[model samples]
Target: MKRILIILFIFLLSACNDNAAVEELKEDYPEIKEVAEQFPESVQEKLAAPTVLPFEPKNVSLTYAGDMPGNPKRDILHTEFIYGDGVGVNLHVTTYHNKNTTWSSDEKTMKTVKLKDGTEALIEGDAINVKQIRWKKDGTYYSIMLIKAPKVEKEYTIDDVVRTANSMEY
Candidate 1:
């Protein structure tokens, strides 16, 4: 009976530890209210808060990385998801602020795709490689970018990235 009790105690402790780890992972996702201030002016003008989250992989967690502040090339916001123990996927969302000139110049090298919603999307690189998809809606220029991730454990495919973009509600 004493041996059984010792084993039960060990099992309970291990289970509790796993739960704590999961909880810690969940806490990584920042509260929108708290991270709102990190958004660039153009993004703030367009979105009340950056709350669009795509379909994340099971056991993978997503966390807000805040706006890429002070970047001269673009006004961007970022979210990072991690899974497979250490692999990460960074999602970058950018806005051009209703500028036709900028949009035209930037998308010069990108292939154009028509989304189901009739939105014209400009894509750089295929789903298998690093990619950036740009589109405009209601005068707000937006982009969904997947940076090169470490090829360890599990890697995301192009279809995954496209699905992530389509999952965007706002």
Candidate 2:
């Protein structure tokens, strides 16, 4: 009877630990966890979502942008997080499975940054002030862009975008 009691106690402790883990995941990835179900299982396995954002987005959307041309197995996914009204801040995140291709810019403002995990990323902006930070992990390329419309008052810095990249959870 003592062995049976010990086994029951262990099972209860493990159940509690599992619940705590789930709760922690939900806390860290509330928005992503809510929307992750919309993706197919294969995509979900490859997808990494940001645990932090520059702002609290009023709207979040995830879209499957179809497979690569000529190669039906490679997929493209896009996610957008929007804050404020018609002409406000828009953060775009895109991921695709493409091992052969990487992106770079010739703009004078372009620079490279090292992420917390030692991955290299590029940040670039055009004359119009649109900025993008891009990096690759495990043959998957990821990009985050900050689009501030003409009416928006605040200008998001490259550091903000870099922070978003650093907070990605795989």
TM-score of each model, paired residue for residue: 0.51, 0.65
- The model with the greatest TM-score is 2
Scored by lDDT, model 1 comes in at 0.52
* 1-170 per-residue lDDT for model 1 (tens digits): 99999999999987654434323334554443244445554544444112223334334433343335455654444443333222455555554443442455666666777766878887765655366676777766566666655563345555555655565544
- On the 0 to 100 scale, the lDDT of residue 87 in model 2 is 53
In candidate 2, what are the lDDT values of residues 48-84, reduced to their tens digit? 5676788776665555565543555545444333333
Total backbone collisions for each predicted model: 1, 0
Global lDDT for candidate 2? 0.65
Best by lDDT: 2
Candidate RMSDs in order: 13.2, 6.3
Q: What is the lDDT of residue 159 in candidate 1?
A: 54
